[model samples]
Target chain A: MSDSSSSFISNQVSDISPVQSSTTQSQRRGSSADQDDVILSIRSLCKSYFDAEILQDINLEINSGDFLVLVGPSGCGKSTLLSCIGGLTDVTSGEIFCRGKNITQLDPAKRDIAMVFQSYALFPNMTVAQNIGFGLEVRKVPAAERKQKIQQVAEILHLQPLLDRTPAQLSGGQRQRVAMGRALVRDPTLFLFDEPLSNLDAKLRLSMRTEIKHLHQRLGGTMVYVTHDQVEAMTLASKIMVLNQGRIQQFGSPEEVYKRPANTFVAEFMGSPAMNLIRAKVIVEAGAVKIQIHREDRAPLVFIEQAATDALRAFNNQSVIIGLRPESISDVAARDPQRSHSAECRIEYIEGIGSDVYATLKLGGSDVISRLHGDSNVSAGDRQQLHFDLSNISYFDPSSQLRI
Target chain B: MHSTIKRPRHLSCLLYASLTLLAFFVLAPVLWLLLMSLSSPTDLTKVPLQWIPSQWDFSRYALLLDWQNGSGKRFLAAMLNSLIIATSASFIALVAGVLAAYAFSRRNASMLLMFAFLATIMMPPITYILPLYSAFSELGILNTKVSLIICYSAMLIPFAIWLMKTNIDVLPEEIEHAAMIEGAGTIYTLRKVVLPIILPAIGATAMLSFLTAWDEFFYALIFSSDLSAKTIPVAIADFSAGRVTDFGVIASVGVLASVPPVLIALFFQRFIVSGLVGGSVKG
Candidate 1:
């Protein structure tokens, strides 16, 4: 059943134009060199609980050896999408392809996938070794191989010394490792992790995140991890799928998603302290395109960026949201005036974060934050000249929220 | 500070005096029964109200044990019958109740089935006595151990399920899901994951079931007409009502009947308290 659907998608891939085909081929090669071949393809997935839609049409493809992350806000459907792939949840309408076959209707066990839950659901009655061997035992793997494999997995997870200990005897982090080892020994086609480190302390979470990345690289197994933590998504995923309100906001390589967000939501959702969004209106005057930003209690200003102007030619007089990362804005007082784009604003609050300073400035009828070096002279309630890099600004249509 | 603390101490003495008087009012009848069991048979109805036995005779205990002289039944045999009935009934009830509790805990079973079972506990046990008695008699099990076990198990399952269901609900569903993802089926997860966490509640339920079986007197008296099925409680009651009541033997049997439950509590006191508290406090 899955074979037919996979063949159908492959057939679809074969019918594209040469330009698209080559681009896709290059893209595939880029991922294939790192990850295994394609193992799971989620197409047009939609789910609604009762009548409230929790996931919209989600389209994602998981290759054989890739660390894919589904990340978003609490109710953005990232966990729902991950659960759908693992068959822990049912999709309202979609097809899930596993190993070149359709497995949307298959039970979780039959899907041949291993998942580590966020809670690290170790069977409290079983020892660490027993928990690790449970999956293999269920599949009727011979007892000897199961034992040997469990031992090997325990060693890999550094749980060999604790093999005789039940989950009740272990700490939270130890139990988490046992949960991972349980999935690890399965050696299945895919691994699903649902915020596995969320229950750990900050130090352990960082270490575990590094370990997961290393393990993925070493095994080169196909993995789909779900987390709301952006740092984990950035560090662990080769491809990140950003979701918002049951819809995919953006799906691309981590760098691509970070550098070229598809919309304001993706841009703001990905960065720490978030990207500052300013409301502005595009205007055309004397055959020149510019933006007029009006801030209450401040003088109005006109700004022009050639790229933004050209891209928004037909969007004159339309309100647009401007996206700027904190680091892209700096204090004009310290930075070379000739090397920076300048804007005038009142300083609202200044926060120092070790190596840099973040000053929240009122500008363009909204608040924009600037990241300055450690010696920045800006202080709270002080009028300041802030410089925003024109080349790094992202413009989004106010209504559609699509990037221009 | 000492003087301030003494004010509550004085108040407590007054409260203690009143509560002690109330306790004596409630316990006076029990004290009278104890005195009656120790006094001579003629002294039982004496108008002088003899609180102490003058002869200090132990012949009643000997006669009650012989049954040939007391109630035409053996105390040892009745004691054995009670043990078998209570243990078997509680054990069977636990098995059935755990299975049904697990089913109700995980799935959304019909309200009608749950309520129908619960309704049995709400009605007095005598409400079903005639039908149950006729069925047992027709099946030749009216005075058998099997009849008591089946009846006790049926009577206790509703309350057990209700108690266990509450404990099971507080457990995170994720634990079961994780077990399932790890390849455990429903039964394996229940036995390995769910059971251990709720062990306290299971123990508490067993204790409650055993107590219910031990304290039951109506069914034992109505159904058993011979030594083979008569339990300790029935035998004790019968001996006390005879033409010559043996007070010492009744007290000894009463002490014996109380031993098992007291031992069970002593051995599992921690589990019983923890389980009951865990269920109530959700900690």
Candidate 2:
């Protein structure tokens, strides 16, 4: 059983080599030369509300034509930062550069970005055509050209038939489309969206999400989107910036952020049925590292691999945490592998979700979850043996919650 | 089976009884006023307060229109003067209040200054009436329509600004941001977006301003000494204090004085309802 488990650890370590190399290469490429591809650069951004600092030292560079999403829990300053970029709010101190020009004091209209608000922000009194044409009219676009652009954008959004109706006369979904059309008609340099689908029902939000994806693909415009929904961030963003307490916790692609979270917060926040965290103490004996797990009247010491040992060497003889995603653990009785790490657990509950089943079990005085193949005979109050896929385990410093 | 059908029949009987009583309570005074306006003046003093008169007397309303009803009072002139004063004062006050309200709503003014201006609204006109009258006399504006307009408008501006500022405060700031990003400046956004959306509140506030001008007694009594500058209220008050004490004429004048406001309230009743509730709540 230990032979196959060791091979799995070796395989995961081998996979990390290529990922690390590519990341370093990209990092080098960014630092070696000042890439003119940065469409907007925000540096040293700070905001305070009557002495309470909401955002501090926020630095971000948005590349041309990239769809970037800022995601965080509530009150994390994601919306505040977006408003700063749009020039709708005053930053305490910062430099906002657009196309190599400092525009920190520029008004929102002069910043050359259009924002679609969560409430849709459509003029309830105006017809669809007038709302679409309003920006152009304000910019002194010729009436003929305004008509042409309005017609074109209306056709693209399939809003031609509804152009004569006011916003209140339209359904929630239709109002959303009009809001999108209002932003699209301007063809501004940067497009900002603040949870644009949040007001719609579940079905409509899904459809609009797909539509927004299609629009981004078709236009290839630079976008900066904000949402508290991780799924929206995962599916739509080319790059995701996770924020916590007004600071950037992690910034990477969806795959990097999910699999190799910088800390425990990212792991727990990005997944449904959140990751299970168990406390363990680390000890090294005979130049080999092992984690001690204590159960009631029983104790099992599991040896850590060399790679994980190296990562945890700084916390020698200190308590550490083991995080295991629900999918990483399974019922060993269901699948007999060539090798596996087995543990005796007492089944606490079983929840069936059609394609797969989730069972909660007690292991070493803590409750852990395992997702296994369909229809297990396990019920509550039954003793069972569960398998832990050690390859998917994560180690974190127990005090700081930082990934080891 | 028959009693089941008859149950609703019993309910409808009580419903009709209550509704008829309610309608009578509401319509009795209005119907009596209309009938009295058509009766001769001499029959008004007769016993039993005649419900209907034998002859029609349309001459009283004609005399009201002709600007002559003896005792040297000019009703037509007074009505015209009231119209000019109320319309001009209300319109000017509305424009100034809207602009100032926008500033206050945006928090662009100093808090001290805002509170000071708001404090003016709580000061009663009776507190400043003598000083205001003396100032008007010194400025040579006494007994002119402009004097009344300036006085009424000054009195109304503080409350109007307060009302509008509260209304504008409740509107979502995002809509204004959207408009600004659409390339609209302050005036354009106000005229195109903000004004139309809050038109109901605007209509309601305008009615309030007009009503204040129409019903004001102290300012009109102090300022207007001649027949040419007197408003409807002062004219009606003067007519009631005369030697004869014509009850019919007083009733006719009372009905006439209420016509414009009642008609306006009926025409814009929907706006009034929305404005009253909307300004106080979501706006």
**Number of the predicted model whose lDDT against the real structure is largest:** 2
lDDT of 1 by residue, A1-404 (tens): 32443343334233422433344345446445643457888887899999898987677776666678999999888888878887778889989999878999877767778899888877665778888888887778999999999988888889989999777678878888988999999888899999899989999999999989888877777899999999899999877888888877777677767766777778888988788888888897777778778778866767765554566877888878888888878764434433346766778999999889888877666777788888888789887767767656778777666677
lDDT by residue (tens digit), candidate 2, B202-228:
887798999899888888999999876
Estimate, for each residue in A261-298, the C-alpha lDDT of model 2 and write its tens digit: 66678778886667787777788877767777666534
Docking model 1 quality class: acceptable
lDDT of 2 at A30: 39
lDDT of 1 by residue, B30-118 (tens): 66655655667666556785667776655555655574553425777887888898888888888888888878878777768878889
How good is model 2 by TM-score? 0.87
TM-score of chain B of each: 0.82, 0.83
Question: Chain A of candidate 2 scores what in TM-score?
Answer: 0.85
The segments of candidate 2 whose C-alpha lies over 4 angstroms from its true place after superposition are A1-36, A285-288, A295-303, A331-346, A375-378, A381-387, A390-392, B1-32, B67-73, B111-115, B270-283
